[model samples]
Target: MRYRPVAFGLAVAALAAVSLTTPAQAKPAASSTTMANTTSAGTTATRVVTAAIPFGQNGDIPVARNYSGDSRYEIAVFRPSNGTWYIRGVGAYKFGQNGDIPVPADFTGDGRAELALFRPSNGYWYVRGVGQFTWGQAGDVPVPANYIGDSRAEAAVFRPSTGKWWIRGTAAIAWGRSGDIPVPADYLGDSHADLGVFRPATAQWWVRGAATIAWGVNGDIPVPANWVGTAKADLAIFRPSTGAWNLRGTSPVTWGTNGDRPQPGNYAGDTGTDQVVWRPSNGTWYLRYRVPITPPPPPPPNCDPSYPTVCIPPPPPDLNCGDITYRNFKVIGTDPHHFDSDHDGIGCES
Candidate 1:
C-alpha cells in the first residue's frame, strides 16, 4: 500500500497546514506545529515539524534520513511529478524524476542514511555519495537493505512476475509468490537485514532464516522497527482499513487514517521508537512523537556570588534585607547586598 498511490483520506482534515511548495501561508507561530493531544491509550505526543507536501502529487511519502548520526531522523518529501524534494529541516534537493521510487538509505557505511532513488525505468540505482549502477529490471520493486551488516544498505529488488528476490552479486532466490509485498529489515537482531515478504492473501510473513508469523491481514503494510529496544526488529503492521498500527505485545494504536504511510522512527531522540504516519492526501504528517525532556537553564550571569542559595542580581541601587525572600541563608564572598552587616556567615539574620 505504501509503494503505490491509493485514494484514501487521512485524519488531518481540520488542521490548517501551510504548503511548502506553494507560497507559504501566513506563517504559523513557533508552537503552531505543537500537537499536545493525548492518544486513546493516554499517551501524549508533540509534533515538532508540520511541513506540507507538494500539491496535485499526493502520492509522495515523507522520506526520513538520519544522516546527522544523532539518532534523530529528519523528514524529506519527494515529488515524483517534477523530481523535487522538500526536506523539512534541510533545504530542498532534486535528484530523480517521476516514476523513480525513493529508497534513500545509508550506502557508504557512514553510520547514517542519504538521499537516493531507484529508477524503475532503466533498472538502475543512483546513490548520493556512491555512484550510479544497475541492479534490476523495469517493474521490479526496490528492496534495499544492509545485507552484510556494514551499516550500508545494498541494492535489492523483488520481481513480481517471478516472485523472487534479486540481490546485488547474488542469484535470484525464490521465496515468495506474486502479490506478496517485499519487506527487508534487520529482523534477526544481527544488524543485517533479511529478505522477507508479506502475503496478503494469507496474512502470513516469511523471513529468511527466521520463523514465519501471521501477524497482519490483507491491506496492511509491513513497518518493522526496534520497538522493544533490543537487538532484533519487532514485527508491526500498519492497517489502513482501520488506521491502526498493530504491534506485538502492545496495544493497537490508531494514528493516521487510510492512505497514510507508516513512518516509525526515533524522532524524540529517546530510547523507544516513535510511531509516525504521513498523510499524502493533505500533505500532513501525524506523529505519535513525544517531546524530549529539556534541562533547566543556567543561573543568571549578573547574579552575585555571595548568595549561592538564591540568585541575586548585582546591586546598582543598594538593597535591604527585605528586598528578597532570603533569610538566615549562607552568605560568603563580598556580600554585595550587605545583608550580612554583622560580618556573619548568614545573610538577613533574624
Candidate 2:
C-alpha cells in the first residue's frame, strides 16, 4: 500500500486492529442501475453540516476531501462501526460500509473529491455514480488513480499474489513483487499517476519510468506528497520508531506518535503540502503545515548599562577571529573608555 493520492493504499493488516466491525444496513442507491454486489455509502447532500463525531472503536485509513473546491483539503474520517464519514467544512455522510476500504478521489476531475470504496470480499468497486464493477479479487490492494490523464480516476488494484496491477479499461502490468507496497502518484508531472512500489524488505522504491531509490526501513510507512507543488511526487516516509516524518532532503519532523497515521496533503491551501495524522484512538486529527520558519527577532540592542551611549546589541553577532565583532566596543588598553577594567561583557572597551 502507500500514501497520498490520486489514491494510495496502506496495509491495515500490519496493524494490530485491522478487522472492521460487523456489517450494517447500507443505504440504497438512488437509481436501480443493477449493482449486484454493490452498496451505497450514503446520500450526498448540498447542505453543509458538521456533526460531532463520537470516539472511534476501530482503526481505518486516513481520508481527505476537497468538497468546497477551495484548494484546501478538509479532514475526513470513515467510521467503520456506522459507515459514516465526518468531513470538516462539509457535512457528515454515510458513503461506505463495514469491510469497505475507503478510496476518496477526484473521480470527475472537478477539483473536488468523491467518496468511493473497494470491497475486497466481493472484488468490487463502488464509485458513487460510476456504478459497481468488478476489478480486483480478495487480498488485492486498491490503488485507484488517473492512469490515462483523462481527469477521471480509474479503478485499479495491485495483486500481491501475482505482482500484477490491473487498471480497469487501462493497461495491466506486472511491476512489483510480493511484499512490495503499491505507491501510485503523478511522479513526472504528467498529470497522470504512475505505478510505483515500495519494497519493505530492501527499503527501496521502484517507480515505473522513474528512478529507483532506497530510503527507509521496514515499519516505516510511505507518505509521499507534492511537497513543492512541482507536479512530481516527493519520496517521504513516517518513522514510527522515532515519531518523525522524513521528507527527502528536508529536515525530519517530530509531529506524529506511534499509533498515529500520517496523511499528507494541502490542508493549508499553500504550495507546500502539510503533514496530518489521524489518531484513531478517539477519532482526532492533527495537521502540521509545512511553513517557512521565521527566525526570532533580533534581541534588543541593549548597551552596557555602564556605557548607555553605545548599544552593540545583546548576545552579539558572529564572533570572528579578531574579537566579538562589536564595532562599538573599543579595546580598553588601546583606546579610551577603559570602563571595563575586567575582561567581561564586550571583550574590548566601550
Error in Å for residue 4 of model 2: 28
Candidate 2 Cα RMSD (Å):
16.2
Q: Per-residue lDDT for 232 in model 2?
A: 77
Query: Worst lDDT window (10 residues) for model 2?
Result: 43-52
- The TM-score of predicted model 2 comes to 0.67
Cα-based TM-score, every candidate: 0.68, 0.67
lDDT of 2 by residue, 1-350 (tens): 21222222322211233233322323322222221211143322221111222323446556776767888987667777666666654556655577999888878788777778888887867665445667788999998888999987878999999999998886789999999999998877888898999999999989999889999999899978787566678999999888899989877877768888777888767665777777777665666553333356998766544444454333335333254444444332322234345656444444
Worst 10 residues of 1 by lDDT: 6-15
* lDDT, candidates in the order shown: 0.73, 0.68
**C-alpha displacement of 11 in model 1, angstroms?**
36
lDDT, candidate 1, 1-350, per-residue tens: 01222112111121133345543433322334444444434545454442333332376757876757788877667777656666665566656778778888887778777777787777777776456777899989998888877777878889999988888867789988889998887888787998888888999888999889999888888888876456567889999989898987787877778877888887667655777777776766555644533446986577788888877787887889887887888889999778888986888988
Poorly placed runs, candidate 1 (over 4 Å): 1-57, 291-350
Q: Which regions of candidate 2 deviate over 4 angstroms?
A: 1-60, 291-350
